[model samples]
Target: MNWLTNWIPKIRSTKSSSIPENLWHKCNKCGEMIFKQQIEDNLLVCTICDHHERMTAKQRLCAFFGSEKCFVVEEPKKYSDDPINFTDKISYKSRLKKYREICDSDDCFLIGIGSVEGKKVVALSMNFKFIGGSMGRALGNAIVYAADLAVENGIPLIIFSSSGGARMQEGMFSLVQMARTTIAIKQVKEAGLPYISVLCDPTTGGVQASFAMLGTITLAEPDALIGFAGKRVIQQTIRVELPDDFQSADFQFNNGFIDKIVHRSKMRSEIIRILDILD
Candidate 1:
């Protein structure tokens, strides 16, 4: 009995099986715990509340074009990585490196060429994981390049926008992207090709002010926050209390700011339908 007690103590002291992190995810809207795999199986939308979760750029491309049909376009070589040599708490270059490693991306914007329901399209998706998907020289270059590629191929252009705003690190260089992207969208429209903007959660700031709102057919995920300025900023400036759902996708849709509030599951099909109609 004494020997058995000693053996039990030794076994207890040994390493125990560790539980995997991120096995379960809490739904941001409903506060329900759901299996992570289940969330992925449902296209990253919460099973309980149907709240659309943010997705990576690659995930978005795969969702729309499937793994086989999606091919990432090479980033253009014309833009400076840190255009203004800016720095804050950390050097802008260091921040870029950190995010690049964490996100496994060259920049926030990922441009791809893919086919949706047999129709070719140039797709650009923003990775909010990379510094809130802020617009800068890289993003501006990507947008212009995507637009040019779409026009050259005579294919539709699709953008999945998930951003906080322009990158403040780059100062005016970041703000210039707003105009650049807008011009890119205009070029796409001038070519008479469909330009679809899919606003995911938290599309705001300079992004919302520019190309995001210029889509020929704009669509948003349910409950997405799409606005130029933050709600708090607007409320403070106007000195009036805003509605609870002020910048929500539903609110924008109701006010005719966006074309539709689409469920995550229906987004692909809806885009395909719109493409067919445009064709």
Candidate 2:
């Protein structure tokens, strides 16, 4: 076990200084090398291409609410672990343990009660790093509870959606979340509170079909992928070719699926402005 963990550092060491591999980041869009600190300062957007990189749920919370104001809202109820006893290459339980450790979250969804620019809000964000932000029973339960909390407190709700879709491991139980989350958002809407959704990159599949698209005001990061089906699959199914930028956020906004395409730099102020209007 010690050998498995210790071999890499020894292999990469140099005579003068250890290589700082994590000190720099390469922009996925522009292929530009940027300092990790610079990326952090820019809220993880690529400085050159202005590409909005996926951020952890905690990072999203920090960006919106800052450390002092944000308080995590506990899930109202815990869901069963390995409800399906699913296993592929590895057990679903093992996968959960791995992602829980990596993302520092019990599930992909992070729900928090916080004030954004002095207005109290319930913020729900997805961490794509955890199982591609897959919507499972825990996440479904979290969203429903968060919606209830927002309604109970008379506060608005905002969800930052960055997901690859439903968790296949949970089978039909995962697909059912599409309805559960949709109904949850409706509860918030019925309370006459604003429900805003910020669609991040790769917001697709069951999530896009559900609460992610049910926002009162739908906003997306520039150039993010916003679609239900993959381009290749759609083209194949329809037996026709698709536009090069068919599923891009800009394309979706032009086609009216999104209300606005916001840049990462102005996201905080834009959200605050909207909250102020609805306040």
Candidate 3:
């Protein structure tokens, strides 16, 4: 027992009573404090309670694959920044450059296949950190690729959707991506493969209008804000008192907008079971 106890670090002395400073992140949904690195290792899940934190597309992909073996959906072909160059907003080139510096990628989505709890499947990961995971050309392309991969590999697909909606900078072309994504997912349904979508915090706009809702099974993290318009806008439009938790994950679950409200700890295992049922 003494030998086993030797591994514990010995404290030289008690320090000042002041609490140690810990870095914190303000959750978009609940406005809670979240520790940074600890959350990363825990699938970006909040440690205090188990709320699913917003994740970047890259971080999400890495967690899903669990390694690099997952086939990457390479940068799309026929993609261009200036679908229509406009000086009214930031120039296409400048916006791209800014996003590139922050996100280090042009795409808001990553689609590919790999094993999770021993079941193989295709998956799409949306990065909330990147321009609010707006569904632009890159996102639409990734969805299409995931659907195609499911058809090609004979595996079901799962998408973790956390986005704000369309990329307005791209104009009408951005809106078109919604149609393209919906049609692409139709291929998966036609192929007789299961398509599951896990909606995290704040899945809205063009994404909500299209593929996010098309999933045969739509799952949402508890208390996520799932809607098209801001709460303020809704109140202004309706001119009435909204429910205490209107548009929240729990509300959606009760209203049939969400199929299931899942916890972060059980997510991977739940996905595994879904894949098993499909197989």
Model 2 lDDT per residue over 149-218, tens place:
8999999999999999999999999999999999999999999999999999989999999999999899
Residue ranges of candidate 1 with Cα displaced over 4 Å: 1-19
lDDT of 3: 0.79
The prediction achieving the highest TM-score against the true structure is 1
Candidates' C-alpha lDDT: 0.90, 0.90, 0.79
In candidate 2, position 105 carries an lDDT of 82
- lDDT score of model 2? 0.90
Residue 39 lDDT (model 2): 97
TM-score of each: 0.93, 0.92, 0.84
Alpha-carbon deviation at 54 in model 3, angstroms: 0.9
For candidate 1, write residues 190-246 as lDDT tens digits. 999999999998899999999999999999998899999988999999999999999
Model 3 residue runs over 4 Å out of place are 1-35, 68-73
Model 2 worst lDDT run, 10 consecutive residues: 12-21
Q: Which residue pairs in candidate 3 have backbone atoms (N, alpha carbon, C) closer than 3 angstroms, thus clashing?
A: 57-127
